[model samples]
Structures are given as C-alpha cells and as structure tokens.
Target: MLHEIGHNLNLDHANSEKGKEYGDLSGAMGHLYASETHPMMCFNAANTFDDLEWYIDRQKIIYKSSYFWEGDLVGVAEYDLCRTGKYVAIKIPKGTYSSRGRYDYYISFNRKILFNSGTMEGGDQVLVHKRYTKSPSKSYLMKKLRSGESYSFQSMTVHVQSISTNTSPGIATVRVTKETPAPVKPVTKHPTSNPTPVPTPGLTPGSTPDPTLNRTLGPTLVPTLGLTLETMLEPTLRPTLGPMERLVEHPMKKPLECSPQQLLKPSVTLQGPLSGKIKHSKSSKAKRPLQHPAYPWNKHSKTSKTKSSLNHPVNFGLENPVWHPVKCNDMLERSCINNPLFFLKVKGRRRNCAWLGRKKWRANRYCKKSNKSRKMVCRECCNSCRICTECSKICSNIKY
Candidate 1:
C-alpha cells in the first residue's frame, strides 16, 4: 500500500546496478515485505519529495558547481534526519551549469525506526540517488556510504565525515570537494568603423548638451528624441483668467461645492474641515461605556462581573505593539508554516498546541499556562482564548 502511494505521488521504483528490479533496500519503493503485525513500512525516498515540490518543506541543501568556485572544501554540512530545524537531504546538479544539467544527485540519511523498520538491510547508511531532470519520477540508486566513506563523479567528490544512526533522528556531516574549474576567457566585440553621434533635439543654443546624446550612436542602435529646457520655454496654449474677469466665465463650468461656512465648522458625520461642528450630545455620551486602562490588556477586570475576554489584547512589544481583537487570528498561513516533519508526541502520545493549532479540540488540552513553547509557537491561538497571555518584555541590554 505504501509503495503504491509513492507511485501515486509520481515516484518510480528505486533501481540499482545489478539489473534486478526494485533492488534499493534503503527506501520502501524498493523490494519490501509487509506483515499484519508490522504493517507500517519505510518512508519514501528524498527524491520523491523533490518530485512532489516539497523541496523547501523537506529542507534540502542544494550545492551547485559554482559552490566549488566560491572556495576550496565547501565545509562539512550537517543534516538531521526527519527534523524541521535542520536539512534532511543534499542535492547536487550533474553539469557545471545547473539550469542545463540533465541529472541531479540526492543524498539522505536513512535509519530503521518508526516507518523505516521494514527495510532491515543497509538501514544505517547515507544513500545517494540520481534522477533525470526531464523525467523526475525516474530515480537510480548510485551508492551507499557508511562513516568515512566517499563517492566521486564528474570531478566532484562527496565525503561523509561522521554519522550517528543510534539517535532518535540521525545526524550526518558531509563535505563536498571539486577540482579547480578552468578560468573562462572574456569575449570582446569590436566595431568595423567609428560611429557618428546623434544631436539632441529641443535644446537651447547656449544650454549644455544632454550627456546621453553626446555618446556615440552605433550603426545598429536607434537614437531617441531628447526634450531639454528649450521645450519648457514655449508659449502657453491658453491664457489665464483674472479675478475681475471671473464673473464672465463659461456657464458650463461647475463652481466649487464646498462653502466657506462648511470648511470652518465640520459636521458630526465628518469631524474634519470638509463638514460642520462634531459634538457628542449629553444622552449619547452617558450611554458610552467607560474602560479602565488596565482592563483592556488584562482579562480579569476588577469592576465588571462579566466573564467575556473579548477586549483583552496581546502585546508583542513596540514593533508589533498590540494584536487587535479581530485580527488576532493565526498569522501562520500554510505558506509561512514552519511545521515539523513528524508529529512528535509529547507526554503520553499527545501533540503540542503549536502542532495542533488547526485542530482546536485536540489543541485545547495542550494550550496550558505551563506550556511555554505554546506562547512562542502559537501566540495567536493562545491569545484568542485568553490563555496564558503576557506582554513581551525584551531586555534593554540585549540587542535582538
């Protein structure tokens, strides 16, 4: 069922050099067996996620040919398996130019635990797979490396410095090195003959010539007309009217709608200069409720007997100031969500509020005053229910 799901996700079988089909044992797409007791199998290969457009979601470190040109020995990069905070895999393009590269290599650290327990063979090793750029579903397993092992191809070498497979989520440090690329020769274009300069138009006789127009116009290039000070000095198309002659103006032309009295006294509907005087009557002012300074920020009001926590605002410092009552909805849209790969269980098989914000009933149990991680991750969710709400107090001594 798992292997077929990979097929549904546009992932082909993981192939190997022995000519036997489904030979790669590191991924579930390869030859595998499932029993009733151990129904869950291994996760799909990193290449499968790449094909599904989860490149950023899976956190893949892509190294191009230009990376080698930047410096020698492009340092040992660490990859944490199934962790959102760190990279899960590394990808390298086949050719010098990444855009034109026909093939791409993906390296990932695989382990035997949870879903990956089905494949017992070569479970604790870094697996490398090559995929054709044009056909993403076609993936070929190239090599498997243990600690200190290295793989070489097309003048580029990937060396595994160290790997820890015993941990919950394994960590692998790998370094990429390449041969110094040959310096490219600069191309120079020369004209057959000297080009003539085009004279700028609409310029005064004594005015300085336009700097751009002074440049030599090439035979193949077209010159644009230039407008200078001479264009502005031309006579006006229409004459202006005098204050005394304004009485004999055209009847079709509309007069100003705003009177001088309306400008001086603004109305209640418009408290600005455009309308008349805006003043609240005694009866209307008496009906308006008076709010205490502390009651707006704090949920527990001393004067009111009502249990509603609607007016309470969450303060996130001067930068964000206050999260308004209506706009306090979760700012973490699917696009900006930095959710973890696996739903890590806390306590007794329960997930944290940060991971379960969308599922309100399941998240309510974890949204406690003691859960400090909840405030940092799901602030909007916590603020909505007036649970464990507090103002952000940044230290003046510290620079963030």
Candidate 2:
C-alpha cells in the first residue's frame, strides 16, 4: 500500500505562528530541495518555501473552494494559476476580453504576496511575463516541470469566492487547469534517497516499479509539485471540492437569511431609494461610532469646496488635527505609514501577517501575544480593516 507523507506532516496553516509550519525543509520532510525562492523563517508567504522531498514518490493536491459573495468565483485553484507557479498554457475562454491578446493570464505563486510590494517594485508579478497566456505547452518552458518540482497554484482561502466541480457558469467562467502527460514510459520503481527499503513484494532484480497511480481528476488542474512528466501533462480534473476551502461557522451576523425586501407590500415597510451610500467612519478623537461623511470632517473643509487645490485641507471649527482628506481608497494612517509594521501597508488584505509598529530596526516579534492569535479575524478594506487583538499588545511590548 502506497502511503502519503506530506499531508500528515503537520505544516501549520498558512497564517499560523508556530509548530511544523515553521520547521526547516532540508530533511524536515522529503521529496527534494534545490533553490531558496524565498525564506520561510519570516511571517510573509514570500518568506515561505515548503520545498523538501520529505520521502515520497508523488502525491496529488486537492482544494475545496467556495464563493464568498457574488462575482467572486475563485473556486477553482486554476484561478491561482492564472496569477504564479509553473503551468501548462490554457486558452482564454471567449468572454473575458473584448479584444483578443489585449488581456493577460498567469498563475500566481503567492497570491497573498505583494509581488509588486516594495517601492523599488511598483509590485511583484506586475512586471513578470504572462506565463499562461500562450497556448499549448512549449518545450522550453517544460524545464520547470522536468525539474521534478511542483509549484503551487493556490493556498487555502476563507473569505473569497472559490469554484467547485459543481459550480455553474452563471457566477463565473472558469476553465480547468489541466496537466499535460509525458511521452516517456511512466516509471514505477520508487526510486528514493531515504532507502528505508519498502520491501517491493514482487519486483524483479533489475525491473523498476510502475509509476504512481494516476489519481486523475476531471477538468480543472490542481497545482501540483514534485510530480512526474505524465502527471504534469495528463488532463486531470480538479476535485469538485475547491482545492483550498475552509469551512467556518460563518458569523450568524451575515445577512445570509435576510435580503432586501421586494415581495412585501408598501404597508409592510416604507422604502425608497436612499439618496446616497451611507458608510461608517471613525474620528481621530475618542468618540462613539458615527455615520459616514461625518458632519465635522466630511463637509469638505475649505479644500473640498472645489476640485481646485485638491491637496489642501479646508479649515474646520473643531480643534481636531486637520486630517488630510484622503480618497476613500487611500487611508493608511500616519502611525501605519511610519510604523515598522509597514508591511501592513505593503501587503494587501487577507494576508496572514501585518507589519505592526515594531520599535527597533529590523527586529520583529510574534504579533499575537498570549494564546488567542489563530482565531483572529481581520477585514481588508480601509473602512473595515481587521487586525489581530494581539496586534495592539505585541506592537506595544516588542523592543522593535
């Protein structure tokens, strides 16, 4: 019986702080290790590279995905491929672009990483060549697969939409990322370095064992690693299960059961098109929650009177610091801008870690303090940014 090793190997979930998730790779697991694409010691996925052979012939990856809201169909892990990682090219289905070749396609290696993060980098991946746009896998690009390394297409996800084998096209138009099969005869002999010597019960002296089972999937390709050429090219369908899905007792607070009223009579409730989009905002001073466009700061201090002098702030009566009016999309606070935790700004939403205000130069600390870090939740938008409860604590305790 062929045994799977890595799945039970105990690597921590992507956002976790400690345990096997942070273990070194060399002999940690098996498969193989050649390059240091990034260091795993740091919190950022950019700092993670879980590449070690860890004693295995091969294994397939499956992800269970879901769509959080409408128009967010990332259910298929192939979606991640459209962004890093080695992949066989796929045709852009008819619909996405009005003009052919005008758009681009790629498989993202680290979706949560800011490929284009640093100042030097307007962002990562922004400048990289569109690896997946071209159709029919080319031989030159075949080197990546031939190297015996299986690059990841997506990590597990909790908030965004994901595709499933059962997903309908009404929500999204996703094609499966399929593998191309190798032309050579498949190898069965389990050639490995850690020769614990599984007693091949029926092997001839010089005869090799057959290649690992196909475990073929149906349509969408699951991002694979350390796979054989046959595994790479075979048109494997993804598990109807989203390759990377997490189930939570989604807060009952979500209005999943309550939607806007339409069938009710006018007497049931008075309804009219609300003139504007109401939102939530916080005051610089300690104050209770208030409506958006707060009468105090949103009335357009003199600077908001007209588009002229767009950068200047209009004077207001309250002595509150004249917060420079920033476009809703840009709201990194002064503390965030200056804090060593600047990674919070550089990294976008849903990422596991944020650069909290660290005190010293390059030194950093565990963002969570006591024991409750894993269950933390953070929102992505500026108006609804989520931060760890411990962030406030660690930010204050660490030396820097």
Candidate 3:
C-alpha cells in the first residue's frame, strides 16, 4: 500500500540504498525518532504477517518497529523526500476490501499517504499483486532525527509459524517498511534538456542539479539541416561538417543526397583517387543555375515579379539558359544553401570551404564532361565515390 502511494506521488523504489537521483539512503540520516517503532521501510518484498483479516474483511493498524524482529531494521531512517522525521505505518482494516494478499505498508506518518488496494492472482507458492492505486494510510512519524544517522534500539525477532494466524476469509499477510531513507534518482524536466534535484547546502553557489544550466543544450536550438517550420525561437547556432561525412561515407550502394557543406567537408581529406580543385569541362551545357526549364532563375532573379513591375538583378550568366520556377521537391536543395548554418560559415576559397552561393555565375562555370570522359569519370566515380566533374557526381543535369 505504501509503495503504491509512493508511485502515485511519482516516487520510485525506496529500497535502493545507494543512488544519486533521490537523496541516497545509505549516505543520509533518518528524520523519525528511534522510539517510534514500525517496520523500517526496507522490507516490503517479503511476507511476515498473519493478519489476513485486515485484507479480506477488516482493517489492521500496525506501528513502527513492532512488526520487525530485533535486527530486522537498521539505525535511523527518513523519507528521502518530504525530509520529515517520521516512520510510516499502515493497515488495511478487515472487511474494507477483499484482497488475495495483505494490504499493509510501512511509511512516514507525516509524509503524504498514497494508499492502494487490489487482489492478486493467488498461487500455491506465494501471491503478489502490483499496486494500482494509493491513498494516505494516516500513521507517520514526527520527531527529531538527523537525515543520515540512526537511533539505538533493542533487537527483536519472530518466527512466522509461532504467531497466531487469522485464517478467516483467506488472504496472505505481508508487511514491509524502512527505517532509513533510500536513495532516489534525478528526474528530467520537460521541454528543457536539464534534470532537477533538491538543492543542498555548500553546493558551490551556482552548482545545481540542473544539467541544462551553463552549458547550453540543444537541437541547434533552431532548424539547420532539414526543412523546419518558422518558430518563435531565436537561437544562435554553430556549424560542423560531421553530419555530412555520415552521409557521404554511407556503406550502402545508394547515392547520397548532400548539402553543399557535406560535399565540401569530405573534399578536405582529398585522399580519395580524385583530389585537388574540382575541374569542370567546357563541353556539355553547364547545369543551369536553375535546372527547371519553365523559370530560368539565376542570381539576378532573386526578387519576385508581380503584375506591376520587375526588380531584376540582371541574369548575366547564359545569354539564355532558360528560367524555371522553384519546385516543392527542390526545396531541400534550396534549404542546404539558405540554412542558418550555411550563412554562419566563413565564406571563401580556403581548403574544404563550403560553398554558400555565387554572386556572379558564368555559362561555362560547371558543365558535364564529354560523354566519353563522363564514361571514364563514371567508372572512377562508382569505385572512388568522389566528384571530379559535374557528371562524376552531383548531376544538377538530372532533372528532378
């Protein structure tokens, strides 16, 4: 019953004697007095009671320390949470509910009670039912005790068969409790990447249980690689070429769809069969900056053309390479260039420099090699998996 109640309170197992999440029971002191006897909160997994009536048709109230044998409990214990110095005691009165097993739990009296009741599928060896609900059982401790120390007490032991059994309506009796607080774990805060734990003294002023503090955590805080809807978030970002290598070095036979940066990052090693400046042939038609034929867009066509007038930048590349409207499918390609990460990169012609864009383009800037060279480049490309010419890889000529 106590365990179920703790579950409702979002508490995990109290038997874990050592952990960093919730305060550690092994290292912490108790809040309850030594005289207030109830079974300490550690023995819930066993069956040591004979009051089966409390689970079937009656309520049975048990006190602290009274249930356990002399050495069953250790020194002082406290509720890891609530910090109250109290030992929780519980009871499920006879006839209150029909259960296949005992319905009593051990806990701190002052701490909130999360009570629960249910029946288990009985078995000849033993019967166990997981808690489904919890409510306060009402008897918790209240007195002076430190968070980690224990009080002295005379040890008491009992034999199960020696005790009188309440064989009335048929339900097993199980009593479990703790004398010392058990350790707890940290919980993750929603929305934020950090986790929070109770504050402690002398924790270095700014030192906190929150992981998100100081070191900023993020998914770049804003969109970078893929298409992301505009958001209210205003976050600064950094650029790295790692994500690109992951794509280019793909072990599978499939081709890689790359961002301009990814393509450039790998070229840094230039260790592949193909190395040095990627040269383009002055042969086949250069991949029109805008591959679509309907709308021949170039650096000059950035401004929109309405019914009124046109504010054009003067498309100077091809006397007429043909213009085409941007397509929905090509958005990924556009995004690679327009990404915040792309803009943040230092623009220049340094080794492994990522191409942001071109201010001025020429008709023969990048063209496919002759079908013959292409055949050779293609053979090399298939084996080396690197670009030497337009036809070698990144074929803008392939209309999407």
Query: Candidate 3 local accuracy as lDDT?
Result: 0.26
The TM-score that candidate 2 achieves is 0.16
What residue runs in model 1 are displaced by over 4 Å at the alpha carbon? 32-39, 43-46, 61-85, 96-101, 180-400
Q: Candidate 1: worst 10 consecutive residues by lDDT?
A: 69-78
lDDT of 2 by residue, 295-353 (tens): 22234233243322224342211122222333322222222211222322221332222
**Which wins on lDDT, candidate 1 or candidate 3?**
1
Residues 1-400 of candidate 3: C-alpha lDDT, one tens digit per residue: 4334344543333222232232212111112224434223422211111211112211224444244421111111122321222222233222223333333322111111121111111111111111223332222111112222232212211111111112211222223322333446888677675665866666466655776658656656554765455543556576542332333322234454654343332322323221222322223244222221122233444433332122222221222211222222211111122232321111232111022222221112323343322211121111112332333344434211
lDDT of 1 by residue, 1-400 (tens): 6677777777777777454578776666776456435344554354444766553565454455255421111101222224454455567766643455676777766655555555644566777777776654557778888888887766667777887755545666776667533547977697567665765686577977587856786675555468646777886676332212221111124332322222111213422221222332233323222221112212232433433343444332222322334211211111111222213222234233332332222333222224433232322221111222122211111110
Count steric clashes of candidate 2: 65
If the candidates were sorted by their lDDT against the true structure, best first, what order would they fall in?
1, 3, 2
Q: Which segments of candidate 2 are over 4 A away from where they belong?
A: 1-225, 234-383, 391-400
lDDT values, one for every candidate: 0.45, 0.25, 0.26
Model 2, 357: alpha-carbon shift in Å? 9.4
Each prediction's total of clashing residue pairs, residues at least 3 apart in sequence or on different chains, is: 6, 65, 57
Using TM-score as the measure, the top candidate is 1
TM, every model: 0.38, 0.16, 0.16
